[model samples]
Target chain A: MKKDKIINRRDFIQTGIRTGIGAGLGIIGFGLISRSVEGKTIWQLDPAKCVQCGNCATECVLQASAVKCIHVTDMCGYCDLCSGFFRPGALELTTGAENKLCPTGAIVRTYVEEPYFEYRIIEELCNGCGKCVQNCGAFGNGSLQLQVRQDLCVNCNQCAIARSCPAEAYSRVEPETAYLLKGFEELKITD
Target chain B: MQQSIKHIKERYIHLTTIIIGCCIFLFWLFYNPVHNFTEAVPGLDNRPPRSSSLGSEVIIGEHFTFFGNAPDPSLTGRWPNFRGADFDNIAKDNVELIDSWPATGPEIMWEKDLGEGHAGVAIYEGRVYVLDYDERKERDILRCFSLVDGTELWRRGYSVPVKRNHGMSRTIPAVDGEFVLTMGPRCHVMCCDATSGEFLWGMDLVKDQKAEEPLWYTGQCPIIDNGVAVLAIGGNALLMGIDCTTGEIVWQTPNPDSLRMSHSSVVPMTIAGKKMYVYNALGGLCGVSAEESDKGKILWTIKDFTPNVIVPSPVYVGDNRIFVTAGYGAGSALVQINKSGGSFSARTLQIYKPSEGMASEQQTPLFKDGHVFNIQTKDAGTTRNQFVCCNPDDFRNILWTSSTTERFGLGPYIIADDKFYIMNDEGELTIARFSTSTFEVLDKAQVIEGDDSWAPMAIADGRLIFRDSKKMVCVDMRANE
Candidate 1:
């Protein structure tokens, strides 16, 4: 009976060790899988497909839409009379509240050269209305585009903005390439 | 009293500590002072309202600004004015444009975005001129670019609050060695130095000339001949010749009948060795004297041969013969001007519907070797929108058609070196031959991927510049090399 009991105890101890090893390995595997899946994907705007219909500003559930205008400095023409900044047919080509195309006054234009003015966007103030983007794409070099900042985004599985987007321009992209900018294509004059 | 004082003193220390903590919390809560958001600086994101109408109160020739610096002049050949260096829409000296495009198609040297319009470009030696409208700033800009790389050289503009009327600018700039003349969509004509972007002179036709804007904005392409810019004003004057150097009005054609202007441009035609400016006005057709002796004098005016609307300029077919066409069921007419007894008399030889004969909508027919080549309008029965060649004598004699397989819609074609460089509305450029009996498309290439490749082709030094609605492209079409 003692021999049998000892045999049973040994069996139990082996089973426990096997169970412990299996659980440990399974935990490690799960940790790797979770790490690979978590925070790796982000919201992206495919600008080529984006129609700039002003939905980016209003569709998001957040009080202030996470979408903001991204200015690609290299693509910008830096015109003294920027189409994105000023309303069409402003009386004088000057910076003023009435003349500004941006509803929230997010873009800041600074003098860079004699005729060139560098435009930078303030993300917090930007409402993603896409009015400036519309004007810029229509008239200027299309440097200004709307993008979803992952830091400000809640990372919803089904984004409200994406659901309402008419162009279906939103997609889950790798964190590295979260924005697609026109005129900044690596390929020169492909079209 | 001592016990009470001792107990009160022990409680006093704890009470004092609580009071101090409360005071610190209150101070932290109310320490920061609040002020309103900074008032937007004056003239920074602040401006007055824009006027709704197009004939802008905004000053003309107010701003002559230089944008990007132009490169050193290297290209020597000149397209000069609207039709190439020569008055005829044909390239001279460079015959190499006849060769077929490479397998990969013509290499697009460069392209730039233009405001939505058919407003085309004019190439002088090394510069490209386009009158572009900035819709946002409410300005009509005269932009100059380098011929080599398409880099913007300089821009001269004036504020004009014009709204989009099916693409704002439509006229092409008339450029020469000394000056460049541009007519804005709102009937404002501007003159500037061709090389320096210097503001030379400005005139508002509505304000100064009493000229009525065309129905769909001006489609009239300006022409400069012998340093004199000839414009079919069609107001109080049927034609006006301005010395491009001084911007001075050299001569004017009287409009006794009060005929309105059409979209047709003034084409220099020589019948019986007499040079005259033939223009198809809204009411009828007139041939104005282009000679220095009697510049701008209406040599002959035909009142009966009139179309409801005329877009394309008349083509010089034979001696004393001109072919005039219009779309919208207006059909085609051949006007033969007989300069007998030192005077001119015009009579319509043949007039027929588009389906019955050779009729064109937007492009003027090419008269070469006694044959007329043009893309027949859709109303043309079997060969609708096909590049067809017909005998000028008999408009219905279709010697050869592009066939159903090779049809194009209202495109532009130019003949160079016995070959035709034809561009379809879908941006397909077909290099064909001027065959007497067949349509031979030697090579076809998609030079541009966009639609509406409608801007008339301009070739200078074997370089061809063309555009659609949005993009302007340049390609080297040198035949020899």
Candidate 2:
């Protein structure tokens, strides 16, 4: 009877420890689900505050930065001699890479009409260099801007780009509505 | 028999799990979150589609951006045009100013960052108007600000791609009660409602008049005379007068000699009871009729006084003398216009090198009380870059100079409240007691910490407006009451 009692106690202790660990895991999983449902914040940068310092390209932890250039077609001037696309003092407004301001040639210029050209950004080729953004703001309508593409973003706990942003343009945003776009302030879409 | 049945059931379950995994993989492959979220509604309904038949390459006064309205300070002051209302850089209003600045320096009323240019300002009532080039927007912006505080009231911009030729936008706005006139770097003239900042009319001198833009952009500031916008257009017409209200070319002096536009501006002078407009054209010196009877008629021309780069406008001294000086070692020339038989003829009296006599590099000398004040050119030998006083009687008589220690480099100076406000290239301001016999700097202070502070200064209502290449500042020169 004494030996049987000792064996039962040992078995009870093992079972209790196993139950406790399982309950703890269950509580953690529930918390994670609730947090996600409540809309966990992801990193974002305000385009208005961004100074186009080229840090979004180099400071990101990923080999290909989540930050990319976004074209706000609504705000574009549709200029033939787009300062953002062509180099300053460009002899001709052509699609030549030598005359292009973009180092990666990510901006595709489409001749929409006479004296009006459309500027589109290729997300994959964009390294978030901000050279185009700087020139566009300097000489054209500020349509070319940098934004963090949430699809490519790994959503790190501490974004490396956010930490190094000189203009303090970076902040955490909701995952569902991820973009911080320009030319939308009048619509009051941004908080 | 029981072991065989259990093993078969387990195999069936494994096959079901594999099928479910494959279905999930297929669903993930087709779904694209980026595509779903960023719904770029690029249809014509969402945005206005840009059409090819919109306009030309350069549009004048195409965009008007309103910042914020400022409270009217109701200040009574006026520095209306390039050289003020009198066509002389002298503020002779009743407002009293301090004789000397405090050790802490003049109280800076306000300051604003402009584009990379040396454009000056025009103060009318309580508003300050400046013609600035926005390099980012690639537009010429005529900005109106509150003189009390540095609040930008409104801005009118037009896109005209101007390369930075020694910086752009080198003209001052001519603001009156009714209209504000601005000439862009490319010789595009815009006239706006002075109070409302409404675009009244625009004329592209290059396109409409075929006026060739000056080498370093249009340095000629526009002037308004009795509601007539006087412009020294030098392509098809040597000089043109536009009706400010109707936007009509009232009179235009035909450019028969094909004189190209120069950096010099037209100065209206009345000599021998005859009113005329004296201009230092790139090719020569000419006087157009400013009278109502024979307006736009070229009366006198001295082809001998032509310089490759003429900057200073013709300074008309008494005794029918007009002093013309130019940089690039062009020296100075004294031209006299004589009226004979209701006809005008110009004669070049004397021409001397900078080292031989009084010559100005940038600004037209201030003639006051029978003495002419000028900052001599760097090529003036002992008087190089020095502020000197000379007699208009002789081109070589330099009575007084600011000395070797005080030199103003291509900067500008103005006379206000019996004091001379001189600025150096580095923006050091010197306030000297206005005296032709002696040079005395009452106080000196650094107003702007930048290079190329060569824009002409404007003062009214005890407020002095000065600028560097990149910034403009206003200081309260009113005496502490």
Q: Pick the candidate with the highest lDDT.
A: 2
- Tens digits of per-residue lDDT for model 1 on B417-451? 77888989888999997676778889988888776
Please, what are the lDDT tens digits per residue for candidate 2 over residues B1-481?
9999999999999999999998999889987867734222223112234432214577777899787766466788999988887787889886878888877877998999999887999999888999998899888999999888878999998887776655687899898789999999888899999987889889988878888766567899999888999998888889999999989999999998888788888888898898888888888899999999999999988887666667888888789999999865578999989999999898888898788898886787898888889998766878988999988998798899999999887899988888898999898999899997999999888888998898999987788998998999999999854
- Chain B TM-score for all candidates, comma-separated: 0.85, 0.87
TM-score of each: 0.63, 0.64
Name the lDDT value of residue B176 in candidate 1: 73
User: Can you tell me which runs of candidate 2 are displaced by over 4 Å?
Assistant: A1-191, B1-56, B69-73
Report the Cα lDDT for residue B81, model 1: 64
Q: All models, DockQ values? A: 0.15, 0.04
Looking at candidate 1, what is the lDDT of residue B152?
A: 91
Highest TM-score against the true fold, candidate: 2
Compared with the true structure, all predictions reach lDDT values of 0.79, 0.84
